[model samples]
Target: MALGMNRDVFITCAVTGAGDTAGRSAKVPVTPEEIAAASIEAAEAGAAVAHIHVRDPVTKQGSRDLALYRETVRLIRASGVDVILNLTAGMGGDLTLGSVEAPLPPSAVGTDMVGATERLAHVAELLPEICTLDCGTMNFGEGDYVMTNTPAMLKAMAAQIKALGVRPEIEIFDTGHLVLAQWLEKQGLLDGPVLVQLCMGIPWGAPDDIGTLMAMVNNLPKDWIFSAFSIGRNQLPYAALAALAGGNVRVGLEDNLWLGKGVLASNGDLVAAAKTTLTSMGAKVLTAAETREKLQLKKRV
Candidate 1:
């Protein structure tokens, strides 16, 4: 691996996340149509890839419905924007334990858990160029909710995703997650030039500090292709840091909601802002075609 940085960097815009953020702002797209439209706008603004997750139209809550995923994929493709479609395989793993004392029949309503195959069902059908594989589990926030994914589950999910020919972008939330990811690589579940996304600054996860980011990056395999993002205000700064560290950048409403304090942002605004930051630092943004080539991604249909 060369220490020299590649001037061409790929930008990925995460359209909407599976969080309880829709109600926070009307700008957050709920329906498939709005999500797809936001994605197209981001692509036009400068993102080469659009990472997606669907929501139930009525409740505006995150959902793993196969039909909704299919519709979103179709709409983005039909838009003819040339952006790579990257679907979320990170849903259906929420586990909200009952009041610390009686945690057995885990809060039935909001807690959704299934086998690895079930989680990847939409990914198998849609066959997007890239799909997320969260490397480990962690206590998310102050709630009793725990994102659960055991080693067996990750291995099973990795094998299934590899079999489907979809590149798994290992989502590493902490240093230990990177250890597990490297183990997966050694087991031959993840191929060479593995793609990774360093998800930083989430509560109870990796901190958004520079030392932590560098530690995570130094541990990655030399030949791996990587990207990094931080939540909230650090989002834009991480873009420049990722470029300087020889990796890609991911931005959009998923990790942030505002372009500035009191300023609501659309997907395009985030991607365009990232582009401006990267280019100002002497880095060239990659087009969809260029990104496909750099990441060795196959075109879908």
Candidate 2:
């Protein structure tokens, strides 16, 4: 345990997630340029990796458009940031059902479903070093909307992602999702040195409390490399907590937007803050090269 205990931890900055968060903070990057700038800033501040999601520039709405993803990746690469790019393949699976009395006719605007391959269209083309494979479907936020990732859909997507030579960072929102991830491993769909991200404190998912976090951490495969994060005000604290718990840390406007009360945070602010927190806990923060080696990621061109 001590030998593993002293290992340097990697930090990931979820630069701009595809969420309805633009109106909440002007700093939230909406377009490709803004997202790329944010990623560069996060890298300058200490993030070895940047987890990205693209949004429609005009509407500022989350999009799975290949062009948007292409532009975002291009901008980041052009900026010369030494950061690992992690694209989100978790889009195009929202399901919004009608009222229980009339469940047959689902809502139109909020519900977007597509084939698993369609969801990974951007990842297939860009071939980012890593992309997320959300392990299971779950209720999201205050809505009739539920995220819909059936096991069959996941299996098909996993096969395609593997075919593209991209590593899948399994996103587990709860204990059950971990069960599904392990099952995928058993079937050999997920490659070795599996990377998992424990998304804690998301609604209807795992809680941020110690016991719950520990439960999810304890259930992970011994050799699996993992990271963990919590949303909102708990974001910075989780950096120390994750490092102490033997996992990496994720922080950004995607999970939090305030450096302090009444102070809006840029992505760099969050990464710098998390780095400070990890250092205070006596944990060495690994760089992009070191993290890539530790995770067994291939070098990006």
Candidate 3:
């Protein structure tokens, strides 16, 4: 068997996201307790890190409730698991437009726009090992809602991340988001060697295509550590694909819900599947400690 270009790669399990996906999958953890348990489980299943986002326990909708984040992080840390925790700094930026004609007043129903500082409230308070910074804003899903992040907003948030000594996982949804991440690095807002997560296959963002993945990878800084994943059925395939492209891999219930056809997946199941795929390709899956060193992350007490 030919050795893969990258022989070692780390897997990040996104436990849950700030998307309305809980309704579709019964296994998606909704409360603080469930999220923490799921995170620890993923770590045991061979994920180097757990990417997290909390939701309203009652409605099962994505939430930015500060208390919820604090409790979730607390539970995970208290679990004595060695997994690296990556909380979402990607919340509080949803912009749902009421209508195209009357875009004057943005829809209040699902829109959670706030100033940059307020958006990082949970991140600042919890100070996890890593946090995500959506490098650019774009239309998110089928709704009029957009994932709102401007350069100015990103700069402000990045500054706080620097001050707090947390690493920012620059999320590149499309090619241009990578450009914005590059600009942020040049401006000294980001620390090196940078960490980036290529979010592909979302509507209005980069398509989940090999050409697109290589193009994005080609443009990244040589020293930067990057991971790539596609949503839905493409999730598992992208695990090996990313390693082949010389990047790490991300997979979890947040981005996908099934381990195989007709098989609903837990966070651990998705992570275990990714580990199996990467190892089969002659790559040694990295542990959480190795991942922390690779990313040069600062641990918060």
Whole-model Cα lDDT of every candidate shown, in order = 0.91, 0.90, 0.89
Tens digits of lDDT, candidate 2, 41-111: 99999999999999999999889989989998998888777899999998988899887678658889788
Residues 137-242, candidate 1, lDDT per residue (tens digit)?
9999897999888899999999999999899999999999999998999999996579999999999999979888888888788989889999999999899988
TM-scores for every candidate against the unseen true structure: 0.97, 0.97, 0.97
Per-residue CA lDDT of candidate 3, range 1-301, in tens? 1223678899999998877789889899999999999999999999989999999999998888999999999998988889998988888888898897897588878788899889889988888999999999898767698889999999999999999889999999988899999899999999998999999899999999988888888888788888999999999999988999899999998899998999999999999988888888889999999988888887665
Off by over 4 Å in 3: 1-4
Deviation of model 2 at 155, angstroms: 0.6
lDDT of residue 115 for candidate 2: 99
Report the lDDT of model 2 for residue 225. Answer: 87
Measured by lDDT, the strongest candidate is: 1
Give residue 70's lDDT in candidate 2 (0 to 100). Answer: 95
